[model samples]
Target: MEYYEGSFDSIVGDLVAGNRVPAVISDEEYGWIISISYPYKSESGELLGYVCADISMDSVVRDRQNYLLSTLLILAGVTAVFAVLYYVLFNYVFVRPIKRMSGAAAEFVSGGRDGEFSSSIATLSVRSRDELRLLCDSLKRMELNIREYVNNLREVTAEKERIGAELDVARHIQSSMLPCIFPAFPERREFDIYATMTPAKEVGGDFYDFFMVDERHLAIVMADVSGKGVPAALFMVIGKTLIKDHTTPGRDLGEVFGEVNRLLCESNSEGLFITAFEGVLDLGTGEFRFVNAGHEMPFIGRKNTFRAEKIRPGFVLAGMEEMRYRAGVLQLNEGDKLFEYTDGVTEATDAGNGLYGMERLERVLCAHGADTPQEICEAVKRDIDAFVKDAPQFDDITMLCLEFRQKTPGIKEEEQ
Candidate 1:
């Protein structure tokens, strides 16, 4: 009875307290609280404990959860609608047309024939004034232009090949005009001679020749025309012919050059000129009579010593109508050698633009002074080839060497 009264009293006291509320706190796994308040009344308006009520918040929490779920469902439905529209619009507006054009371009590059583009693919109708449309138009035009351009290119290439073949034939003919067989007139034991020419291109203006005017006289000639290629080659042919025609046994070297110069000047076209050296050797006497027309000085070698011979200069042939050349005479002893060449031989260039000049040529001759004419020529060629290894020969390289030997006392003479 006391315990029940105490509990009731405590409840009534809490309710009576001014502005106080009764609360039940329960410990569950998460915990919970329930609170209630009641007004109290007494006699003459004095306060007294009355009644109270309380409830837990579990039902309100469940309603809030239901509201959140509804909101999520609405958002997911909206997203699905947007996704379906986006995929359909994207496929229609972008993907299909691009795939078609890509296929067409691939086919075109892989040697597809004209009008072979797939016709089943429809032209894109989603036209906007943007870069993609312009790109497609440009591609189509480029395809057409490429086909025409390639056809034109083939024709041009074929024409070029034809012209190249003709030029090769011309080059061969020009080479044949030169005397390639060495040691010409080898049976004449008095001297040995050798010459060579390497043109800068298919044909060149430099030339050399040696032939006997008679049993006692040998005519040697070397010349360079003013230019290169076919025009110069033609001039070279004319100049070579005139020089050989005028040089004969018992004829003066100066007169031979003078006559040739006048003849060249009369028919000179294209303003061509030639630097030349012509010599007539008396095999029996070892006497050399030579004329120079603006040519480089010749080197004379005897007994392993070589030196340049100073000769009077005359005007280059074909420059003037009445040019006269004077002859210079030098006595060559037995075992003496003479070297003559066009400027091209000394002017051959390396990649560094250095000239194979007179100094180097002289050094070459001096170094190989004891070698025969054939050997000397070979030595010079080898040195130049080494000096300008892998470099293009920039000019016509030509050289001639003549060696005099004394006739034996008992040797029988052969009739010419």
Candidate 2:
């Protein structure tokens, strides 16, 4: 074979420029070749010849492609194995436990009042020694606490409902004890009487009564007991019964109160007392005899003008034993009215802590001049409500109004 010469200009130029670069070229003889060159220099670093080498790139390219293919295949196999292992480990360590906890929580919430939630949460198990286990344990304790709290809440709610029901019944019973019917003395036309009581609570201590002791004498009572609610209401019942029982047409007013006071003092175990006012109006003579026991002053309306009656109040009933009370007498003419009330009217509070005082009461009474007893009471209540807008009533309010129209002539007294 004839020898052939090949040009290596690119490789020689790179060697001269102090670059150690290899060159690839296509050749008729070698098909594909890579030429590399290194300079053989003198000790003084002068220009010198180059030592060159040519490598067949076809085999090298094929070998490199084979090596890359093998590497990629090995990498793909390793990655597939790693992915499978990861899926198994992750499912067992994290996903499975998490799913179990989620299922148990769902069941607990949906279990309802049959109490299966406790068992569902308590039986949950997490095998991992990580935050999952800690969370499972915490969930169990929380479930127990929540269940106990719910049970206690149910008991308390039931107890409150029972108490509310009892109080409702007590309110109705107490209301029935008073004279709720209107036209109290419909048979007699000598006087027109109207009275009302508004309790601060379900039951109150304030009470009023009007009944005929005889055909000639009409007895009226207005009283307030100490305290409020059940205890005071019970005391009110006793006091009202005692007052009515002792009042008679022939008995002296002072003597009647004296006996009632002694009886109340004997059974006053609760330290409760009453401020009471009782009056007997003789319809024939227009004579009014009344006793004041630590009670508010009565208003006398004469000639269309009202004035507070000045009477010295005696000690409250049940305050002490052997307390002597005095009686006051008033001559009632035709068209005269007597208005009586408890301290609740004068002491009614407003949102601003101001009192609906005696001044306001007297003003309200005077404003409703010559009005009927019913109209007068309604006027006063309306005025009080206006003055005490949105404020809670702090005491029991009671009122009684009796208008003496005329003396009944030729009316025979009924035998007692």
Listed per candidate, the RMSD to the true structure in angstroms reads: 7.4, 6.8
Q: How many clashes show up per model?
A: 1, 0
lDDT of 2: 0.88
The residue-by-residue lDDT of candidate 2 on 1-416, one tens digit each, is: 12223555534556667655545454655676766566677789775777767778788778989999999999999999999999999999989988888887788888845654546888998887899999999989988897888788888999989987888898898888889898887888899999999999988999999999988899999999999988999999999999999997689889989999999999989999999999999899888999999999999999878899998999999999999999999999999999999999999999999999988898888888699999999999999899999999999989999999988878655521
Highest TM-score against the true fold, candidate: 1
RMSD of 1: 7.4
Candidate 2 accuracy as TM-score: 0.73
Model 1, span 204-251: residue lDDT tens: 899888888887788888899989988898899999999998887778
**Cα-based lDDT for every prediction:** 0.79, 0.88
Quickly count the clashes in candidate 2: 0
